[model samples]
Target chain A: EAGVTQFPSHSVIEKGQTVTLRCDPISGHDNLYWYRRVMGKEIKFLLHFVKESKQDESGMPNNRFLAERTGGTYSTLKVQPAELEDSGVYFCASSQVGAPDTQYFGPGTRLTVL
Target chain B: SQQGEEDPQALSIQEGENATMNCSYKTSINNLQWYRQNSGRGLVHLILIRSNEREKHSGRLRVTLDTSKKSSSLLITASRAADTASYFCAAPALSNTGKLIFGQGTTLQVKP
Candidate 1:
């Protein structure tokens, strides 16, 4: 039942530095998500959270990126100052809230913004 | 900004043969999901098909949808080698806000 969990699987920062990635959803699952995939691309959608609010973030990609969940079970995506295409791979997903479920993802972090 | 495109991006079968992947999208969607990633990990849903539905299966995987050609297809019969990996197709925009949108994947290689 523990299927969504992510935290520093890999992260190498540099360009302006400031990174923070963490996700822990699966327990109660209230629908949390954040996705990314640079190099070669095709894995986007960058915001969603149904527990602590924030049901959508219009695929966040600017404002230095920033995501939080606070009391929503777990979620954090902060990419301040980072650049160099912001490296890639930083997924985290969860589901089970409005039905039509099945999201479950995590084991991604691999950010490298040299 | 990616909600379509996925085809022969890569594929090499052998194990038990049988591997097909194709997905194409642009707009209007309510469901259509398929995911499986290996090299590097994360992503593994593999089947959703909604939007009125057209076909779906799980065990050996088999999905097909063709909303007037919006496109969608994913077979995976006897393949193995853990079925190689990298196969994605997702959708959920049209303002539903479920936020999905993904494609650009296929890379399957089951050589044994």
Candidate 2:
């Protein structure tokens, strides 16, 4: 089966600019998640979506960061007025609803905010 | 706060040798999972061990969990140059959100 896929494998933007990253999860997967790994840091959770509804968003860094999963098929994460610290690799993962622990990750989008 | 912490941030070994990595977590969990990521690639799930079990083996990989100490260890035997990668251990939070808490990861280099 095809694993999760992300668009724009690399993104470079300036501070105060806006950027959006997209993720298309495996077909029929009910659980989708977002995570980020900053330079020299661990990969941290961002949010999770169960189908169309968000299951958890406590990991979202701030209001400037927004994530949406329309029609429960794919997801989009947008950073408005991005900050320099926002530069990192953003990963998207998916798993079956019953097997949430075994996640399949996508090639991350490396974002560099200058 | 970070839940898992991996030991020996980096390791290097020759091919056909054995490599071991350890991970410790703060909170209780129902299961722990290991993932591997090659350079510039996404993470690939390697194995998962539930709390009720103590040890699991998959091909050349062996995983042992110690609930009393809240620590887990991963051993890769007969390693090859292709085994070079970063290994991460993850566990679900106590909140039931299904969100995984990951460690900083252990980088392994197997020289051919």
Candidate 3:
């Protein structure tokens, strides 16, 4: 089966500019997630989507970041007026619904905000 | 915030030697997973040990969990250059486990 896939493998933008990163989960997978890793830091959870509904978004950083899973098929994370600290790798993952399953990740999008 | 922490930030070993990495976490969890990532790539799930389990093995990978200590260890035996990667441990929060918080990761280098 094809694994999770992400677009624009790398993105470079300026501070105060906007950037959108996309993620396409494995087919038929209802659970999708977004995570990020800043320089010299651990990867962190951002949000979770089950089908067309958001399961949780507690990890989302601030008001400038918005993630949407339209039709629960694919996901997009948009950073408006990005900040310098927003420069990092954005990762997307998917898994079978419920617990006790493993999540597969895609090649992350490396975002550089100058 | 990241709940899991990997020890020894980095490690190096010969191809024939074994490499072990440890992870510790705070708070309760249902399961803990391990993942590997090359220098410029996404994470690949290595193994998962449930809260009730003590040990699991797949190929050359062995993972052990100790609830009392809230820690886990991953051992890769007879390593190869392909094993050179950053290893991370993840523990999903009890409420929304689909979102996994990861450790800082142990960077392992297996030299031939």
Fnat values, candidates in order: 0.77, 0.89, 0.83
C-alpha displacement of A23 in model 1, angstroms?
28
Highest-lDDT candidate: 2
B39-58 per-residue lDDT for model 3 (tens digits): 88998899999999999999
lDDT of 1 at B79: 90
Question: Candidate 1 residues A39-82, lDDT tens each?
Answer: 77688888899988998898798999999898989989999999
Q: Score the docking of each candidate (DockQ).
A: 0.28, 0.83, 0.74
Q: Using DockQ as the measure, which candidate wins?
A: 2
Steric clashes per prediction: 0, 0, 0
Find the 10 residues in a row with the least total lDDT in model 2 chain A. Answer: A95-104
Rate residue B24 of model 1 by lDDT.
Answer: 92
Error of 3 at B23 (Å): 0.5
Q: Quick one: best TM-score, which candidate?
A: 2
Following a full C-alpha superposition, what root-mean-square deviation does model 3 have from the true structure?
1.4
Residue-by-residue lDDT tens digits, candidate 2, A1-114: 888999889999999999999999999998999999897688999999999999999999999999999999999999998999999999999989998877889999999999
lDDT of 3 by residue, A34-79 (tens): 9999987899888888987888888899999999999989999999
List chain B TM-scores, each candidate. Answer: 0.34, 0.98, 0.96
For candidate 2, the clash count comes to 0
Clashes of 3: 0
Per-residue lDDT value at B28 in model 2: 88
As for TM-score, the candidate ahead, 1 or 2, is: 2
